[model samples]
Target: MPSMIEVRAPLEIKVDPQGGWELAFWVLDSFNYATPFRAMLIEIAEALAQHPIRSVSLPDYIVDEDFVEGTLLFNGSSLRVYYEHALSYLTLANDDRGVLTIVAQRVQSRIALI
Candidate 1:
């Protein structure tokens, strides 16, 4: 059996238009230092492609009501990636349609910034 949690696109991609690709580059650039991070990112992308919601679990940090601030998770660990640094925010909603809408709005806002 697979993990109960499913991995989706990096949350940053939904909030930041350029964030996804930019993150890809950063991961590549910092391959030496960010190897684990990069690997986790790739794993997330792959999991999303295969099983968007059934492949990974949400980071505990996101579950905190006080932690309105978002961060990145990789290597089964949480890594702080500031909102300003993100190209987009990846939202997970109870409803699939809601998730798409939230992600879309964030992407639009990110595009507007450019």
Candidate 2:
């Protein structure tokens, strides 16, 4: 039997006119297992869904010459969420939601798991 999956809504949901919602949906759908990655994605979605436009303060860090702007929070021991702009694609570790969605769509092609 397949394991059960839990779904929860975040406090807010903000999507850019360009493609933020689409990107977020794709990222949520890419989970194959209930691993940390999947949980992290769900947590992010829930947080966004609940607090859509609200800003959550996170740590700061410098990247290259320009500072990577946004709140920073630890997703896990190895992962970090670097949220830059609201309604725009946010970066999770090395992959951004938009990029991840694109990759997931490309790999699955005609079908989507989530």
Candidate 3:
């Protein structure tokens, strides 16, 4: 699996009327466009629903990056990436209110489960 997936944080970008989201927010500095990102988020929700990822530790404190920074494996590979960018890019990028709500719930549930 390709390593690295972040579960948190926001991003910023400079906007020019000449360019749309590609200039502003920069999709968390990756190239996947918005539509594909929406679908990926949905897929994440569904995957967790079907077979939730069990936590490896309680309280889940990490001493370093190695602990928390790694691939999220499903079906023996990471999420079908768009443009080979990090999945976390979508997590951090601008999302619709409903989409954000869904992601929030998913993260909350995962935290509770852990």
Candidate 4:
């Protein structure tokens, strides 16, 4: 399994003037080292933000009407984004199982470990 770390800060969902959506990222003090990773996340976020809530396509790993959880692969990294949707905003979703946190991990190649 890859080592995962939650991105607790620097994530925000923004609303466009035309009622579309976008994901904004602030300066993450500790995450400055992962510029490429952040870029990939931004690309994914933009894809999801450009569309309407109900119309957005999410991974079918967890089937729920309002909550979504799925892992995405970009090159050699794995990113997981999960959140609950309201009428106009995204909320941190939690349940008896646990909170679905946004996390990222690098998928290292086995041959590279040699």
Candidate 5:
């Protein structure tokens, strides 16, 4: 099996009349973390707009519990990311409501077995 598979996520962008563009608020909403983490999320968003993402996964030996949920401040409200599994799936929650979610569709790493 491959180490990772490319995945594409449709992003929302807004273009003003003057030819300036910016990501929708919802896209920024999920990136309420430290500078590096936020920058990484922004990079992912920008990359998704161009093509599929292929190299954004943890090593196979990493376990789910090794990942930790993240919380941060956004517009005076609390935003959080819940890691369903290490870099494979996550949910972005804002002030108790889920605003965004991401799932790596073809990832081979195992989170659990039933």
Candidate 6:
């Protein structure tokens, strides 16, 4: 079975004016390292080919130690995605039943006229 962890539920995704993606409103600290959390990021990355998701970094097996700060599960250019495993800095996400909402915002800041 996959490991489970709590994040600030209601995984909200947004695109800024410059077309930058954003995720998470709370900090992800400390996790069940032994059991890797099935983050939706990976699935989203696979589903969305047009997105700029480079890769998803999951935990290694045989690693029974608790997840500490600096652990990563997502990778991309100009995007810093890290999982900090710390008990003192943790919050349980109660609403997001693991479904990530994708908000597609259309930005037409610069349109070339033919």
What TM-score does model 2 achieve against the real structure? 0.21
The global C-alpha lDDT for each of the candidates, from Candidate 1 onward, is: 0.30, 0.32, 0.30, 0.31, 0.31, 0.32
Better of 1 and 6 by lDDT: 6
lDDT of 1 at 36: 36
**On residues 11-103, what C-alpha lDDT tens digit does candidate 2 reach at each position?**
223343433432222223222332233333434534433231232344333332121233323232122333322222234332345443432
> Where does candidate 6 clash, by residue pair?
29-84, 29-86, 30-84, 30-85, 30-86, 68-85
Native-vs-model 1 lDDT?
A: 0.30
Task: Supply the TM-score for candidate 6.
Answer: 0.32
lDDT of 6 by residue, 46-68 (tens): 33332423444444533444432
Clash totals for all candidate models: 15, 12, 0, 0, 0, 6
Error of 1 at 53 (Å): 20
lDDT of 5 by residue, 43-73 (tens): 4433333222332333333322434455433
Compose the digit string of candidate 1's lDDT tens values, residues 1-114: 222212223233233332322221122221133123323433443443423243344344322122123334332333233221132222332222344344334333222121
Residue-level lDDT of model 3, residues 78-104, one tens digit each, is: 322122243324322122333334444
Q: Please report the candidate that would top TM-score against the real structure.
A: 6
lDDT of 6 at 19: 38
Candidate 6 at residue 54, lDDT? 40
For model 5, the run of ten residues with the poorest summed lDDT: 103-112
Q: Predicted candidate 5: what Cα RMSD to the true structure?
A: 14.3
Residue range with the least summed lDDT across 10 consecutive positions in model 1? 22-31
Off by over 4 Å in 3: 1-43, 47-88, 91-96, 111-114
* Winner of 1 and 4 under TM-score: 4
| True-structure lDDT of candidate 6 | 0.32
